[model samples]
Target: MKIAGFDIGGANTDLAIIDFDQGGDIENIKTDFRYLPMWMKNEELGGYLLDLIGEEIDQLDAVGVSMTAELVDAYETKKDGVLDIVKKVEDTFDIPVAYVGLSGMMNASQAISDPLQVAAANWIATSQIASIMSQNCILVDVGSTTTDIIPIKNGLECARGRSDFERLGTGELAYTGTLRTNVAAIVDKVPFDEGWFRVSSELFAISADVHHVLGNITTEEYSCDTPDSAGKEKEDSLRRISRVLCGDLDLLSTSDIESIGDYIYAQQSLKISEAISEVAEREFLDEVITTGLGRNILAARAVEMAGLDFTGMDEFLTPEECVVAPAVGTAIMMEDYLSDE
Candidate 1:
C-alpha cells in the first residue's frame, strides 16, 4: 500500500510518501519540503502541491492532510481558509482523502463542519508519533515559523492544550523559529563591543540573518528571502544583522556583528529552554526528542542549555524525514488506521 501525507503551513508545505509491502511493512519513504508562501500566492498552491508529488500521486492508496495555513492573512476568517484549502485538495486529487483533525481522521465534509479541529493540528500528528516512540519524553519541533514543545507520557500524548491559544498559555507553543522570525521578537537589546545596545524595531533583520552570520545554517539552508531582498551571501547576512543595531558594515566591525548574532541566538535558545523547563517540570520527562529544520542549530542547543539529555530525530529518521516529521506521522497514522480496518 502507498500513502501520501501533507502538512500545509503559512510558509512551507511538507509532503511524505510511504510505500508498504503486502504485510504492511515499510518499503520506501520519500519526502519533500517546499517553500510555498501560501499567503502571497494562494491561487498557485494547488499547482505547486501537484508539482511537488508529480507521478506518485497516481499510485497512492489514500491521502492524509494536516494544516496550519488557515491563520494566514489571505482569508477573512479561518473557516474560509479551511474550506478553501479543502476545496483545492479535493479538486487536485482523486483519492480517499482524510483530514487529520484534533479528534481523528475525517473526510473533507466532516472537516469542513469542524474547522477548528483541523486548524493548526499538525503538531498533534507529530506528537502522536513521538508518543509511540517514547512513552516518557518531550517532543520539541522547531520549524521555520514556530516551535512545538509537546509532552508524551505512558504511550499517549499528554499535551495540556489542543488549540494553539491554549498551547501558548501552557508553554507548549513558542512563536520563535529558525527562518522567518523577526530578530526584534527574540530580543530588544543585544551586547556588542563590551556594551549593551537597543535594537532597531524597523523589521530590517530576521532570525535567518543571525543564524547565517553565526554559521548555524548554510547559505542554501537559509530558505526564506533575505530582509534586504538582496541575497543569502554571508556578507549580506552580516550586513542585515548589523542593521538590527542600526549599524551597517561601514559603521561596525565583523566581530561586532558576530557578537550580535551570538547574543540573539543565546536569547532564542533561552526562550526554548525556558519553555522546555516549564513542560518538563510537569511530567518529569528526562529525555528530549528534537526534530524539524532547526533542531540541530536551535533545539539541540536549547536542550543542552536547559541541562537535559537530548536525542535528535536524525538518530531515528533520515535527515530529509526529520524536516517533515509531522507529514510522515500523518501518513503513518493513516496507514495504521487503514490496517486496523
Candidate 2:
C-alpha cells in the first residue's frame, strides 16, 4: 500500500510519501518527502500544493492531512482548506482520506474538546521518536508564526496550558522564525553607514533573507516573501535588506547588510533560547529535543546559554525515516483502526 502524510504550516507545506507491500508498519517502508513554500501565494496555494504532488497524487493508495492553516491571517475563509484539499485528493485519485486527529492514546471525542488544540497535534512522528529519544524532555518545534515548546514528561506530551492563545504569550510561542520573521519584530535599531537608524514596521524582508546575507541560513532555505525568489539578484537582496531596515543600499554598504543579518540571527537566537529555558524551568526537563527548520541553530544557542545537552529529531531516525516520521508516526498510531479488517 502507498501512503502519504501532509503537514501544512504557515510558510510551507511538507508532504511525505511511503510505500508498503503488505499491511505492515510504516516505519518499515521506503519514503520520500519535500518541503515547499506555498504560503506566500495564498491565493494560489491550493494549486501550488497540487503541483507538489507531481505524479504521486494520482497513484497514492491512502493519504492523511495535518494542518496549521488556522494560523493564517485569512483563516476565516480557508479554515476548511485542509478539508477542501482532502476532498481534491479523494476526487482525483479515489483513495482513502484520513484526517489525523490529536489522539493517539484517547478517543476523538475527548481530543476534540479543544479544537484549536488541534494545530499540528495530529502529527505522531515527533511524538513517536520522542518516546524513545528522551523520556523527560521538552520538544521545541519552531515553524513560521510560532514555536511550540511542548513539555514531554514520562514519554508523553504534557499540556503546556489551558488554551493555544495562552501558549502564544508564553515562551511556548516565539513568533519569530528563520525564513519568515519580520525584521521590525526582531530589532528596532539598525546600524547604517556608522549611524544607528530605526527600522520600518512594515512587512519587508523575512528573517531568511537576513540570515542569507549573514551566511547563517542557507540560500536553499532563503525562502522569504521575495517575489520571484528563484531569480532574485544581488540587487534584489540589497533592496530587500534595505526595506527591512528602512534604509537604502546607497545609504549603507555591503558590510552593513551582513551586520543587519547577523543582528537578526542574534535576536532570533536569544528569543528561542529564552523560550526553551522557560519550559525547562516550568517542567524541570533534563533533556530537550529540537526539531523543525531552526532546530540546529536554536539547539546550539540553547546549549551554550542553558548549559544543557540538546538532541535533534534526526538523531533517532534515518534521513528518509526522519523526513516521514511525523506522517508515518501518525499512521503508526492509527494502525489499529486502519488495519481493523
Candidate 3:
C-alpha cells in the first residue's frame, strides 16, 4: 500500500510517501519539505499542496494530514483554517483523507466537525510514533518555528495538554525555534565589547542568522525568508545579526557579531533545556528522542545541558525521515488504522 502524509504549517509544507507491504513493513519512504509561506499565499495553497505531491498523488492508497497553519494570520479563526485545508485536500485527492489529530485518525467529515481537535495536532502524531520506539522518553522536536516537549510513558502519549495554548501552559511547547525565531526573543541582551547591552526588539535578525554565523547550519539550510530580505551569504547573515544591536557591519566587528551569535545560541539552548527540566520533573524520563531540522545542533545540546541522554532521530530513521518525522508518522498511523480494518 502507498500512503502520502502531509504536515501543513504556516511557513512550510512537508510531505512523506510511505510504501508498505501487506505485512505492515515499510518498504520505502520519500519526503519533501518546502518553504511555502502559507500566510502570504493562502489563496493558492491548494495548488501549492498539489504541486508538492506531484505524480505521487495518483498512486496513493490513503492520505493523512496534520496542520499548524490555522494559527497563521491568513485565517480569522482556526475552525475556518481547518475547514479550508480539509476542503483543499478533499478537492485534490480522490482517495480517503484522514486528518491526524490528538484523538487519532478522523475522516474529513469528522475532522471538519471537530476542527478544534485537529488544529496544531501534528506533535501528537510524531509523539505517537516516537512512543512506539521508546516508551519512557521525551520527544523534543525543535522544528523551524517551535519546539515540542512531549512526554511519553509506557508506550503511550502522556502529554499534559492537547491544545497549543494548553501545551504552552504546561511547557510542552516553546515558541523559540532554530530557524525562524527572532534573536531578540531568544535573548534580551547580548555581550559585546566587554559590556552587555539590550538588543533591539525589532525584527532585525532571526535564529537562522545566529546558527549561520555559528556554523550550526550551512548557507543552504538557512531556508527561511531572511529578516532583511537579503541573500543567505555569510556576510549577509552577519549584517542582519548586527542589526539586532541596531548597528551595521562597519560598527560591529565579525568577532563581535559571532560573540552575539554564541550568546543567543546558548540562550536558545537554555530555553529548550529549561523546558526539558520541567517535563522531566513531571515524567522522570532520562532520555530524549530528538528530531527536526535543529535536532543535531540545538536539540542535542539542550538535552546534554539538561543532563539527559540524547537519541538522534537518525538512530530510528534516515536523515530525510528525521526532519519530516511527523508526516511519516501520520502515514504510519494511517497504515496501521487501515490494516486493522
- Residue 70 CA error for candidate 2 (Å)? 2.7
Query: Which ten-residue region of model 1 has the weakest summed lDDT?
Result: 127-136
Q: Write the per-residue lDDT of candidate 1 for residues 67-184, one digit (tens) a residue.
A: 9998899999888888999999988889878888887787899988888889898988898767766888999999988999999889777788898889999989999999999999
**What global local distance difference test value does model 2 have?**
0.61
How many Å off is the CA of 327 in candidate 1? Answer: 0.9
Best by TM-score: 3
lDDT, candidate 1, residue 238? 87
| Candidate 2 least-lDDT 10 residues | 105-114
Pick the lDDT winner.
Answer: 3
lDDT of 3 by residue, 158-261 (tens): 89888999999998998888899988889899988788999899999999999999999999898889987889999999999998889998899999899889
Residue pairs clashing, model 1: none
TM-score between model 2 and native: 0.80
Q: Please give the lDDT score at residue 124 for candidate 3.
A: 85
Whole-model lDDT values for every prediction: 0.88, 0.61, 0.89
lDDT of 2 by residue, 165-272 (tens): 666665666667666777778888766667877888886776766666766555555544563243345556667778766667887688778877776677778887
In model 3, what lDDT does residue 34 have? 85
**In model 3, which runs have C-alpha deviations exceeding 4 angstroms?**
none
